[model samples]
Target chain A: SQTIHQWPATLVQPVGSPLSLECTVEGTSNPNLYWYRQAAGRGLQLLFYSVGIGQISSEVPQNLSASRPQDRQFILSSKKLLLSDSGFYLCAWDIGTGGTETQYFGPGTRLLVL
Target chain B: GQQVMQIPQYQHVQEGEDFTTYCNSSTTLSNIQWYKQRPGGHPVFLIQLVKSGEVKKQKRLTFQFGEAKKNSSLHITATQTTDVGTYFCAAPYGNNRLAFGKGNQVVVIP
Candidate 1:
């Protein structure tokens, strides 16, 4: 069975603080990774997705960036957080095949930028 | 990037009532996947629909893929409080990437 894990389940940081959220997947290799943000009562917004190590696709232009250092390790980072950055950050993975992707998400991290 | 548009972004259903949410795409789709996310939780994959005009069911939930392959629908029967969550439909965009619908937030009233 494959499982996804995320860290800092809950985070509270002052404005202009740096941000680092980590996600790791077990039982899978070369999986496609994605980062999403959901605002309060809003829809899931795709922030970044990585096809392979060091290959990232940005969906939204913002202060946040994503990195895939290892095959199954993905990191979402921000140099300086903005108030608008407060939201639920989720990490997901897919098999990346057949031109069809079914995503499995992690526990996610709730961020509050004050 | 392809965008899947879902209708009735918010749904308020009375217990035991039946309701449906729709997802549409301007271009034909090879497949579509559904997911459910509970309050304060991450999204979980529900099911995937392929083959034009396909229909699949899971207990009280029925999923349909349009014959044109450009639309999908999820129908839930006998709504329960356990069904309260946001339902999102997604389809492949670019190589191995999926574009998710805005989601239909189902609020079940007991």
Candidate 2:
């Protein structure tokens, strides 16, 4: 069975500080990875998606960025965080061709920027 | 731009009562997938419908895909407190990335 893991289940960062959240999937290779943010009282919002290593598509422009450094490893980062950046970050994987596919998600990371 | 919307942003049902949520898409979709998220947990895949007017069932839950591929619905029979959570319907709009509906928050009262 395939499983996804995310680091720092919960995080607290100061405004203007750097941010890094990691996601790794075991038991799957070349899977499509995605980054999503869910704000309180809001639905999930797609931020970035990667088809392969070094290939990422930005869904929405904001203070965050995502990278697929390794086939099974995806990272969401920001050089300087903003108060609006605080939200629940989720990592998802999909096995699809041509960009239309079903996705599986991770436990997620809750970030609070003060 | 493609968009999906769900009706009844929140629904409160008495345990054992029936419940249904509707999903509508701004543009035609190739397929639609359903997911359920517990209060504090991640979303879990429920089922997927592809063919037009397709209907699939899992135990007490029934899913339907509209003939126009522009709408869908999820119906739960005899709801239970365990069924309390948010239900989301998602569909791919010409690409692999799926656009999800705002979701319907279901609260089952025991």
Candidate 3:
């Protein structure tokens, strides 16, 4: 069974602070990883995705960036956070091959910027 | 960029009633996938449709992909209180990226 993990489960930060959210997957290797954000009562927005280590694609470029340091470890970071940057952050992984495209999501990290 | 539009932004129904959410795409899709997100939780993969006009069912849930391969729908029969959540239709945008719709938030009153 494959599982995704993300942390810290919740965070409160002042404006203009740095941000670091981590995601790691187990039971899979070379899977496609993605980062998504959802605002309260709003839909999801694709932030970044990586097919492999050191490869990241930005969907809606803004104040955030993502990195794949290892085969199953992905990190979302920001040098400075904006008020609008606060949201429910999720990490997902998919087979990306073998004719399957279903994505598995993590527990998610909720960030509140004040 | 591929755009996915889902309708019935929100819905409230009796626990035994039926509900459906539709999704349309600006461009043709190789495949479409459905996801459900419980309130305050992350999105979970529900199902996927590929072949044109394909239909699949899971228990009381039915999923359909349009003949044009540009639209899809998810229908729930005799909805349960546990069905309360936001349903989203997503399509592959590019290489390995997925574009998700705004989602249809369903509320079931018991």
Candidate 4:
């Protein structure tokens, strides 16, 4: 069985502060990893996705960026935080290919930028 | 990029009553997938429909893909409090991206 893990579960950052959220998957190799954001009572927004190590595709461009340092490790980062950046950050993984496959989500990291 | 639209951005249903939410696309889709997200939680995969006009059921929940392959619908029978969540429909497009509908946020009143 494969499982996804995300950390800091909850984060509170002041304006202009740096941000780093980590996601890791276990029990699966060469899986497709994705990063999504959901604002309060809003729909999921695709942020980034990776197909292989050192490969990252950004969906919505902004100050946020993503990097896949290893086969099972993905990281979302920002040099500075904004009030609009507050939302629920989700990490997901799928088998075989990318987006089309059944995706499994992590517990998620709730970010609050004050 | 291809996109899907969901009707009734918000749905309020009396517990035990039945209702349906739809996902429509302007272009034909290879398949459609459904997911449910509880309030304050992440979305979870529910089911996927591949063939056109295909209908699949899971207990009280039913999923259907249009014969034209441009739309899909999800019908839930005997709605319960546990069914309170946002339901999203998505389809693959381009090389490695899935287009997602805005989603239908369902609220079941007991």
Clashes of each: 0, 4, 0, 0
Q: What is the CA-based DockQ of model 2?
A: 0.63
What C-alpha lDDT values do all the predictions have? 0.93, 0.89, 0.91, 0.92
In terms of lDDT, the poorest run of 10 residues in model 1 chain A is: A94-103
lDDT of 1 by residue, A69-107 (tens): 999999999999999999999999988572386799999
Model 1 interface DockQ: 0.69
Query: How much does each candidate deviate at the interface, measured as C-alpha RMSD after superposition?
Result: 1.8, 1.7, 2.5, 1.2
Q: Alpha-carbon error at B91 in model 3, in Å?
A: 0.5
Chain B TM-scores per candidate, in order, are 0.99, 0.96, 0.97, 0.98
The C-alpha stretches of model 4 lying farther than 4 A from their native spots are none
Predicted structure 3: lDDT = 0.91
The sequence of per-residue lDDT tens digits that candidate 2 reaches over residues B1-109 is 5688999889999999999999998678888899998988888999989999999999999999999999999999999999999999988764558788888999888
Please give, for residues B1-110, the per-residue lDDT of candidate 1 as tens digits. Answer: 88899999999999999999999999999999999999989999999999999999999999999999999999999999999999999998777678889999999999
Which of candidates 1 and 2 reaches a greater DockQ? 1
Model 1, position B19, has a per-residue lDDT of 99
Give model 2's TM-score versus the native structure: 0.97
- Across B36-69, the per-residue lDDT of candidate 3 in tens digits comes to 9999888998999999999999999999999999
Highest-DockQ candidate: 4
Candidate structures ordered by DockQ, highest first? 4, 1, 2, 3
Better of 2 and 4 by lDDT: 4
Residues forming the 10-long window of minimal summed lDDT in candidate 2 chain B: B91-100
lDDT of 3 by residue, A1-64 (tens): 8889999999999999999999999999899998999999888888888889999989876999
